[model samples]
Target: MAEFNSNCSTTSDQDDSIDIQQLMEDIDFDNVYSMEQEINEYETDQFNIMYNTDDDDDDDDDNGTIEKSVTLKPIEEQIKSEKLNPLSTTIVNTKKPMTLKYIQDEIEKIPDYLMKRNKVFKQLIYETLTTMSISTSTNNMEDLRKIAISIYKIMVIQTYQLLWAAYLKSGMRQLIIPSKTQRAYSTMLPIWPKEIKLLLQADKHVNENETYFNFINAQLHELDDQLKQNQMKLNIKANHFQGYTLSIQNIIETYIEQHLHCLRMEIEHKIELIQYDYHIQILKLEYLRHKPNTFQKQLMKELCHSKYEQETTEQEVNLLKQQITYYTSTNQSFECLPIAHNSLIDSIQNSQIRQQLFLQYKDVAKQSRAKIFALYMKTAKEQRDEYKNKHEINLKKMWDAYNSTSDNDKISSTMLDLMHQRCMKISEYIKCIYKFKSQSFVSNSKS
Candidate 1:
């Protein structure tokens, strides 16, 4: 047997595999606005400076060899930002020598998710990988490298969440992205580098064990406060740690603490296409227990079942209406109903599908559910039995009472109208059951 690959991520976001959602978001999140914002700000500042400046010249045109002056402080600050990057300490993202204006464009198209709401979630996941590292960790370079790689996965997901939250807040949800752009639209979930980071960089090495735990707690406290203030309305899920064994290192811990986390969240399932907003705590346990494979299976089942019920019920109702017409055309002079009418209802009621329906209903209780299914099952047994039994009994009773003078065609026509009435009632029954079930589900949720 071929060995199965165990490297599949719970989310396509994790593995940089085929995350269609990420692909779609890539166009949106791709920082496309940095240059515009910067240009506008700079122009405004330039106008203000030019207006306020004093010029003393005996001859305005003749005395001037006019030159534009660039400020050293702002440029120096920008240079420092480019020099020492927090993301990559080794060499920085100097693939192209970018000015502040260039970086501004990156920020505009998409706000850096790594810089926003997702930071906390990334930290939590990173903490888990850190905890796991203790068990699988090696003192050697290779294991340290693997642990760093795992941390990158956590960071990538955090970036996705951050950018998504920023988009929601931007109120650009309905700006119809042109179809051509949408085809290239994918979410941006970039992996942090696999390089091992030194948590302590050029800080005085304090060999105090007590200081380490306290420092982590202090950083967590600060982050918690920021999240509570700025992120009162987001749900953030993270892999939970059992016991108090996990601890964060210095600067990495401090950097994460400064970024705010959102406690209120509007959660959406891509496959289920269902959405609801809830406090993060309410879904925290559920998120921790998330099994992607099982969720996909459950979503498939729900969609299939809903479609099957709708199609089959429509077919059955149409079949009954057609049967009313079929029986109407049978010989009128005989003044007799056909044996086929009773046989049809009886065969359908006893069929495998009907048995399955009964079994499906049998499992439901009237406690919290009050399922519409029970109503359907109860009605099927009663109405179907009535139709079959009456067809059998009335055929014999009417045959004995009637003479050849009776217009059997007219009588059958009356029966067809009656069947039409029953069909209407069945349609009403199906709708009412669905309405009742919806109300019950709402009530149950509130309770």
Candidate 2:
């Protein structure tokens, strides 16, 4: 019979048991051919055994062998072939990166002083521009542009300081790292090249020949002229309205006066009827009735004579005339009062007059408002000029302070630069922001 004994690397460890754990650990794709070879060899033995003594073979000799070399060279090669270039790795971003100024350009070599000066000026201009541009409308933004023109003299002086700082720093042999305070001034740093360009452009954009005050006055002239013309127009309107009101008031007064005169005359005539006319009629009737012979009796008869009828007739006639005059005058007064007041009220209520008055009032108000605005602009410009002058003076005062700290001026030197840069960048940002704000406002308004 054929011998069925099989040699295996890990098949002798257990009683008729093959450990799968050892197979998996020991086998890999690199050695799959070795495993197939072992399987074929086992099958060959099985076939031979079956032909020779298959019925006599015991279950104890039925163990299978597995050979896996665990060679991973092929897999390793595949992995190598699929590898990606390090530089080609995809980068994910949530938000776009903000633009930072090209600070490196300021320094051609390490420890370039221009870099520091650049930072300082950047800070100064940034602050100044921001101050100017924030919330400015197109109408108001012009002020910033004009104001930028006024900044030249100040700019020149600061430039001198930078040159001076450059000279001062030339004597230092130490590698400079600015202080914390100086670092704070970095916030005011301007992109010097960009700022200088913007400023020069803005400065030159305004005609070099135009005077500063002239620009200010030009802004004022149109507004002032309109105001003066409006004032004159308002003055005329006010005078006209005043005369109208007075005329109406006088007409009303005359009507009332005439009414009162009529009432007085009527009362006087009634009294005259009761007193003078009544007395005259009474005397005439007494004279007609008294004819007694004895003087004393005739006087008694005269005193007793009844003239009531005649007196009543005269009184009634005079009363009737007074009533007629009173009624006529009263009717005239009532008619005149209504006509006069209605005409006056009509004029008052008329839209033409009201509108004219309203327009005139607005004209007056507008004149004043415009004048105020003009004055405000003038004052603001003047104040700015004054402030700039004061700043120049302060700069001069700080010269000694600037000099006194020359040995340790990494801070002040940085401050001057930083402040200047803050001024410039702030100025430019202000201009941009103002322009954007104006465009947005106008767009919104149109919408």
Candidate 3:
């Protein structure tokens, strides 16, 4: 990294004032107005110098005046000049109308200060540039020269720019405080310059005790007058308040008395109401206490009945247990199917008897199924009759709604909606009928 010395060293106290004063004088009004023009001209000149092919050397023209052309010195000489004084490059006067001779004279003194103050910075930049110029990455001498020239130009321009900024800031400071000593302006800090040395430099703090004591004394007197006026106003207000106190007290007492009377009446009424409610509650409690307890008798009866049932269940359980013990003692096996009697089951198990019993069961089942079918048909007919009645009611309602509306469009839309609802109900009824038929078929197959 190429680090430029941004800390522009201050000159002697005498030269400092002269430089600041000279700079203030040299800052022409025209220069402020034509600042853009100056920048543009400087850029054009630099561009011309970079690519100008008319480098016919410095020659005398017909007017006997020497014409200056673009020229570059050898790198060794340039390095030597830099070592001697880096800012030795001719300062181009960007402004044409404003003469910069005074500026030049003032600037000429800066080199010594910079040299003495920034010796380390100079050595760093020199070493960096030297390393870069000699690096193997560079293609040729021309590139190295260009790089060195650009770096030097940048360093000088940045240094001057910083100095100019500091100058302007100090000038403005002096303008604001003309009593500021030249030594103060000279040692004033700059807007630029990021070096550690600049931070370490002590700044002179300007004592602000410039006749402010008189101003403070004047302000104190004004405040005392204001305090006195406020005291007078307060005394007048107190006198006025004292005059109003008796009437205000009477008004407050009357208002309090009125509100107290109203509160007393309201409290009496509330107390009466509360007492009446309390009496009513007492009567209700007495009545409830005297009322018949039939519900309690019923609960007792239910409890007694549950107890009897429980006792009977226990006795029955005991009897079953006794029977189970008797069977266990006889070594009889437990049957999964409940049969009324073993003898009856045995009788049915005989093949001829079993066939006869099966035929009898079939005949009974057929009779029961016929009765169930007849009942289902009767219920279905009743349901169909109810559906027809409901459909007629819905149609009557639709017609009523249609007649109630005078708008033809509303009638038509209402009719369409009603028809759609009717269609949906019909489809649902059909589906139910289909389900019933399917159930009948299933039952027949099962039989």
Per-model TM-score on C-alpha atoms: 0.15, 0.21, 0.19
After superposition, the stretches of candidate 2 with alpha carbons farther than 4 Å from their true spots are 1-348, 397-399, 404-416
Model 2 lDDT-worst window of ten: 48-57
Lowest-lDDT window of 10 residues in candidate 3?
Answer: 1-10
Q: Which residue pairs collide in model 3, if any?
A: none
- The Cα local distance difference test for each model comes to 0.27, 0.28, 0.30
What is the lDDT, from 0 to 100, of the residue 441 in candidate 1?
29
- In angstroms, give how far residue 406 of model 3 lies from its true place: 7.2
| CA error at residue 368 for candidate 2, angstroms | 2.5
lDDT score for residue 328 of model 1: 29
Q: Compared to the true structure, candidate 1 yields what TM-score?
A: 0.15
Candidate 1 least-lDDT 10 residues: 270-279
Backbone clash pairs in model 2 (N, Cα, C under 3 Å; residues 3+ apart or in different chains), count: 33
lDDT of 2 at 242: 19
